[model samples]
Target: MRLKISLKGAVQGVGFRPFVFRLATELGLKGWVINDSSGVEIEVEGEEKALQKFLLRLNAEKPPLAHIYSQDVEYLMDVGYATFEIRESRGEGRKEVLVLPDIATCEECLRELFDPKDRRYLYPFINCTNCGPRFTIIEKLPYDRPHTTMKTFEMCPICKEEYKNPANRRFHAQPNACPVCGPWVSLYTSEGILKADRDKALKLVAKALKDGLIVAVKGIGGFHLMCDATNEEAVRLLRERKRRSEKPFAVMFRDLEQVSVYAEPTELERALLLSPERPIVLVRKRRDLASSVAPGLKRIGAFLPYSPLHHIILRSVDFPVVATSGNLSDEPIVKDNAEAIQKLSSFAHMILLHNRDIKRRCDDSVVKVIGGVPVPIRRSRGYAPMPAKLPFKLSRKVLALGGMLKNTFAIGFEDTVIISQHIGDVENLETLRSFEEMVFDLMELYEFEPELVVCDLHPRYETTRWGEVFAQSRGIPLIKLQHHYTHILSCMAERGLKERVLGVAWDGTGYGEDGTLWGGEFMVCDYRGYDRVFYIKPFRLIGGERAVKEPRRVALSLLFEMYGKSASDLNNETVRSFTQDELKNLYIAWSKGINSPYSSSVGRLFDAVASLIGIRQKLSYEGQGAMILEDLYDPLVKDHYAFALEDKHIDWRPMFYELLEDREKEKVPSRFINTLAKMCLEVVLRIGVEKVCLSGGVMQNDPLVSKIREFLEKENFKVYTHQKVPPNDGGLSLGQAVYASL
Candidate 1:
């Protein structure tokens, strides 16, 4: 029997070709395997029994790194081929190959990295087919070395032999290189004066870290500005330079044990840290090694070294490093050496440069364990380019531009949607340029010419406007997605939920259909459309967008709604956040609705509660107040506050009154979360949707989400939360794409 098989998935950059070659030889099959835009195609002739075994073990005993998402086999007449061979990849086709995400340094590579006798020992660029850079280094489709950033580096003799050997692990590894031929690292002064190169560069970086000097070190995806995590002065200096004041910096530990000593990680968190993805995992802070690292927060973002370069650096350092993106606050991470020297030198005393060019700018991915369930917060780095295999195939090629904050645009064709890596907020020109570059990069990679473009309904959003121009210029249909609805749909799309679901979309701000900010939303929705069935009672953002920075304004607005003029008279922490004059002017503004946009956002409610309770009255970063409150959650406090759910409206006035009467501010976090859970139960029961989807930025709140999931699941409601994608605006692109397809 002869079989012509077509396989599609994360099979290209991975050791799939080599695995197939070896498999065919072992089966005594006469065949050839070749790569294509859609993935691998193979033709094999063998005995019927051997052919059956080949099919079984093809996936069963396939390469550990390879994933076969879809495989199609056709019986063929024997061509009398004498030998099995690996042929050159084919590029002419509808490109559907799943671009593999960058993998962290595997245990085997790490072992070889430190081994003194190994040829690649102490080599910073050590990698095999099982691990190292992928999506970050690739330039185009077929995922061949010639089509990657590694194309310039001619392979050394030993590496060429290893790369061509089907039996070797480095076989067909796109980024495969030895120290003699691969990219080399260099240490430079802020003025671009070269101080050292290669191993010496890493050693100098380690020394700089130990000596409390910040060093901008290049890594797999992009540069990471690192400092000793235990050094308060170093961390403080980094914070000052990066202008990232309150947002917690992700700490890179030497190993799992060191991470355990700093942050309390559950078993699953430990697994995530050790996983090939190597995402920064948010876990409880067991010991505040550097008090300034995560001020006031009980949890910290922690991760292990993902690359051999990072491993070598960590081995040399006495203390774990504070690793944050190599960019100023809110800007895209610096990628190229010139960009690092130009922009990053302002933040670092020394720059650890590398010759390898990053084809895409990807920030570190983030995940947090909520009630023992790992929820991806930011999907980037080792988690991007590898798309979500859609439950339903699209009729036409589509583009979905995500919302403003934590922006990520996506492209969809067939049954797959490849959401771009975290593009950061697209408000600024640099980040917007990054977004634009990535959009075209994906389009060019897939030969995609979208039949439709999808964006949020917010008219003022940069991405929405960009999408509008793109659609108009290309003469394609444009579809605007609702912000919160897509948050729900993102989760639904990821979960393959096409049925009507009670979507609980709670975020800080999203443009409502009525032209107001809608954050706290409950919609009965599916892929096609949504009905705003129930929502939190509208409240004024007294200073408009300014309310987002100052939670006190939101609290003030809520108080004024309940107590009228007497809200100013109530002498408390929240009221005292403003002087009598400021209070009076803000109240007047609230009363007149001057520059005060109304919002039904649960995110604002969290901020209001955070301000009212004095946990945090102002924020330096998005979700700072709520994140602080998450730490204050007392599981011992089983009690909850009071609220009114009446006629498609959630009235928090009752809860505020109860909250004000209660003096135990510590109980506020858990109680408020419980109340929200009960509120969700009330609405879901009323709306009568058995399947519930939790989404939006507020869904990132561990305490609140855990409570909601717990309460809903106990009622036998099939509650769904984001697993493959984030619930925040970062994951909204997936939903927009899903909506476009439906």
Candidate 2:
């Protein structure tokens, strides 16, 4: 009997080919197994019973990361092959090959770490085919050891044997290494390079934690700010040092069992915890952990230690650790040692250094529970560079600038669209540099020189600037797509929707095609074209740039729109923040239409509502006002705050007046947010869009997301949201990448 099999999903990086080679040889089967662009293909010749047994074992047992989505087996009558041979890979276009992110250390490596008899015991870098770095270390395609960062470090005699042995787990493992030949960890205290041993280094880190000192530790992908999770004082001290207020910190647990005390884990969550992709999972808090760990938050973000280094650190520490990006607020993760020393010095007293060179910086991914499933908040680190299959293929290679905030870059070659790890806001120079470096690195790795580039139409966006520069330098044709159109395209790509869609692009703000700020918009769109079907009534941005940071300015904009005169003319000093002259200039700008672009942005509306209800006057972060505003209402129970919907437009003036009425009465609750969410969702449903695609940075608001999704379901309309990618700009590259393909 001769059998032909096709295997799919995450077979690349993992030792699937070699595993098959050994398995076929062991079973005395005759045939060949080769890797194609689509997936691994195998043909085996053997006795009928033996072949059946091999198929059963293959399905029952597979490499950790290799997910066999489907296995199609066909019996062949012809047997032209001799003994089973491991054939070379077939690299072709239009084939679906799984691209996996760099994985954490696996259990086999962990066992060797603690084994005193093993040469790799206590080694910081111990990896085999089962686990270790993949995407981060690869310098070129075909994913062989010679084409990776590991090429610089030659394998020892023992390692060489393991690499060549078909039966060994380390066979063809691109990043296979031990402490003897791999990266090493060092302790840097105030004196620098402390003479302490590895164990003492761990102890010193623990002592620093006990003393309420922050430590910056470098991980496989990037640096992390760490402190004792059980100590409220330590957590609070670190929070103050990092300037993070109220945003929840991700806690790294030693194991799944340790997490149960704080939050319950479902079977899917348990499997995700144990899976190679050790992403941070958000779960409801049990009220035992200190509130300071997640200030003003009901739920907690938790993750199990994915690497051996994390496990070793957890062993020395007493509680769940607060591990966050090692950067000042809104900046990219610090990758270089010198940058970590300079930027993190203010907050960190000591640094656990690593000799491994991190060519790129990837922030820890954040995930949250929504509709009884994990939705990625920030997509990076554990899951990136993996190509999401597109329904249509591109005509030429292209590069895309995602968005400004939570920025990420994307590269597309043939059928594969590779999105870079989370790049921070492009507003900062450091983040911009990281984005450029990663883009260069990925292009070189894939041997792709983009023939085209794409960016948002926004002229002020740093992403647009970078894209313009790169396109000019490389002489690549550039495509400037509408921001909201790209947002709709993203939803379309995710759902594999190739035809026209009722595109609902509601966000904080986007540069409209007609030289205006557009956010809340409904479009009838397809891959080639789209038209703005409906939009919210436009209003002035009172202080322009100042309005984004100060929600009070937006409140004044709404007030002036409702009242005949500017809010500043009312003699309220609070309103006097904008002088009568300043108010006159603003009104002139609105009247003459100099810089004021009419926007129906739902995000700015949320900000205005938040400030009107006194939820937040000054926003410390981008979505702070909207998040706090959403927190004020519960959609579970009935609430009566209603907004008049006229045709396809939402009349926000009534809601503004209602807020003024409530302010005069001095009453507010979470129901206000719930009412607005219900009203907005109701209007969307009334427009008769069968599928409501929720997007934008504002969609990061969980409370509003919950209310809207529930209400849309009740209205018998299908609601779609970003799950494989983030709802924020961190996921913008994916949309941009797909759009470039189109």
Candidate 3:
């Protein structure tokens, strides 16, 4: 009997071909197996019983790293093949294979890395078919070595032998290399002068970090600015050099045990830290080390070593190290050696250089456990480039340009949508150019071009303008989606829902359908359309965009709306911080709405409460105010503040009046978050919907979402929160792409 089989999904770059070759050869089957753009294809002829067993175990005994989304078998006439061979990959196909994200070093490779008898021992680039750079090193499809950055170096005789052996772990590994032929790391001064190379260089890096000096170490995706995490001076110096204040930094530990010493990780969080995709898990802080690590927040971003170099450096030091992206503030991570030297030298005392070329720049992913489930905050690095399977097939290729803040783009075709890794804010030309290049890079990799383009409705967004220009240049149809609606759609897309859902979309700001800023929103929506049912009462951003950075201004605007000019007499920190004359000028701006814009943003409400409670007055990051407000939550206090629900508006004026007069300020954050959650439930009850979707940036708040889920689930409503993509603007493009597909 003869049969041909086709396997789709993450079948490439995961030893699928070798696994097939070994299985066929062991079963005395003849023919060949090869990788193509579409996925893995195999042909084999053997006894009927053997073939049946092969079919059964094909998926059961496949490689651990491989995922089979769909598999098809076709009967074929016997070709009288005598031997089984692993044939060369084919470049021609529809390119339906899912591209995998870069993975962490496997246990087998880690065992070999430290074994002195092993030939590749102490090799920083040690990787097998199960691990190493995938999305970042591969320049094209077919998952062959020639298509990867490793093509620059030819394999030596010893390594070449391993590549041909089907039983070997390194068989057909795209990045298979050793000290003799693979890429090597070198240590250089900030001036770009080389000092040491290979193992000695890594040892020196450990010493530098131990001595409280900052070193930029190149990793799988990009360079990470690293310093001793326990050294307060080093942490302070990093904050000073990067001009980054208040925002937290991710720390890298040697292993999970080391991570447990600093932060408390749940069982699921531990699994996430130890998963193949080793993302930074936001765990609750336990023992205190450095004051400036996370500053005001109770949680710390902690992750284990993902690469052999990380393993070696971390194993050398007793303390953990701060490993944040090596880039200027509000820019993409630095990938190139020359680029790192030029932009990162101002902050890093030393730079670690490597010859491996990174085809894409991906930052570390961040995940937090909310409601006993892992929710993505920033989806990049180990979690990106892996596509989402759409519920429905699309008519044509679609391009989705995400919002201006936390920008990411998406490409959709057939039933697949690939969301680009986080591309930072498209605020400056440099970031905008990076965003454009990455957008095209993914398209080129998939061999796809858009027939239609979708973008946010905001006209001022660079992504919107870019999408318009691209659409015009290609003569493609273009569509614009409301920002908050796109957020709900992203969550809907994750669940592959087709029916109507009550969406609770709350964020800091987004361009609304009515030309005003919308954040706190309630809509009965489906894929086809939506009806806006309720929204938070509108308030003003006192100084336009400037109010985003100053929580005090947001509080002033909310106060003015509630009490007019006499509101300045309140005894809150925000009111008392300003003099009578300064308050008078601000009141004039707020009352007359000089440069202020009316917004119904729930994120600003969090900021206002933070300012009123004297917790946070300014923000250095996008979610600083909300995060701190979440930190202040007292779950012991179960009561909620009052709010007046008008016909279509959820007025917060009564809540503020109660907050201003209440002397129990410690319980305000809890009551505030509880009230917002209650308001959503109130609106949902009024709408009379069975299924609900919670999305938007404000939904990233753990305490807030937890309470909302508790309230809704108690009513037996099917509440759906983000499980795959993020709830913030980072996930906007995925929503837009899925919307276009429907």
Cα deviation of 202 in candidate 2 (Å)?
A: 2.5
Screening candidate 1 with a backbone cut-off below 3 angstroms (N, C-alpha, C), the clashing residue pairs are 520-601, 520-602
lDDT of 2 by residue, 1-742 (tens): 8999988656877889787887788888989988776678899988888899889888777786776755789998856677788787766643455556878788888988888999988777788888887766665556677666678788888888888777888887877777667766777863455645465776777788777778899887878999877878888888888888767788888787788888777777777666677888776666557668876555677888777788888866667788888888877788787777777878888988876667667777777656555677777877886666677787787888888877777887665577788777788787777778877887766556888898888998988988899999988798888888888877777777776667667788888988878887778777787877667777877556777877776766777778846455664423655566867776666556565556677788877766765566777677776765544455444554657767656677776566556533233445555665666576666567676677776666677677777888887878777777776666667677777356
The segments of candidate 3 whose C-alpha lies over 4 angstroms from its true place after superposition are none
**Best of the candidates, lDDT:** 3
Q: Looking at candidate 2, what is the lDDT of residue 448?
A: 69
Query: What TM-score would candidate 2 get against the native?
Result: 0.87
- lDDT, candidate 1, equals 0.89
Q: CA shift at 598, candidate 1, in angstroms?
A: 0.9
lDDT of 2: 0.74
Q: Give the residue spans of candidate 2 off by over 4 A.
A: 1-9, 32-61, 67-82, 85-99, 111-121, 152-161, 179-181, 236-248, 260-275, 288-292, 413-415, 566-597, 663-670, 676-686, 740-742
* Tens digits of lDDT, candidate 3, 1-742: 8989998999988888888888888888898998899899889998989889889989899998888888899987888998999888899978788888999999999999999999988899999889999999989897889999999999999999999888998899889999999999999999889989998998899899999999999998899999999999999999999989878999999998888898889999999999998999999898876889899889999999999999999988999999999998888899999999899999999999899999999999999888788998888988888888878887788899999988888998888889888888899989998998998899899888798899999999989998889999999899999998999899998888888899999999999988999999998998777899999989999998989989999999988888888888987899987889989999888878889999999999989998998987888888897888888788898999899899899999999889988799889999999999899889888898999999999998888889999999898888999988899998998889877455
Q: Give the range of the ten consecutive residues with the poorest summed lDDT in model 2.
A: 663-672
RMSD each, Å:
1.1, 3.9, 1.1
- Writing each residue's lDDT as its tens digit, candidate 1 over 1-742 gives 7999999898887888888899999889998999999899999998999999999999899888788889999997898999999999888888888888999998899999999999999898999999989988888898999999999999999999999999998999888898889999999999999999988888788788889999999998889999888989889988888888878999999999888878788889899999989999988888887888999888889999999988999999878998999988878888898989999889999999889899988899999876557888999988898789888898888899999999888998888899999888989998888899989998988888999999999999999989989999999999988898889889888999878999999989999999999988999998788899999999999988889999999999999999998999997779988998998899889999999999998889989999988877889998888888788888778878889988878999999999888888778788888899889988887888899999988888887877888888888999888888888899989998888466
Q: Give the TM-score of candidate 1.
A: 0.99
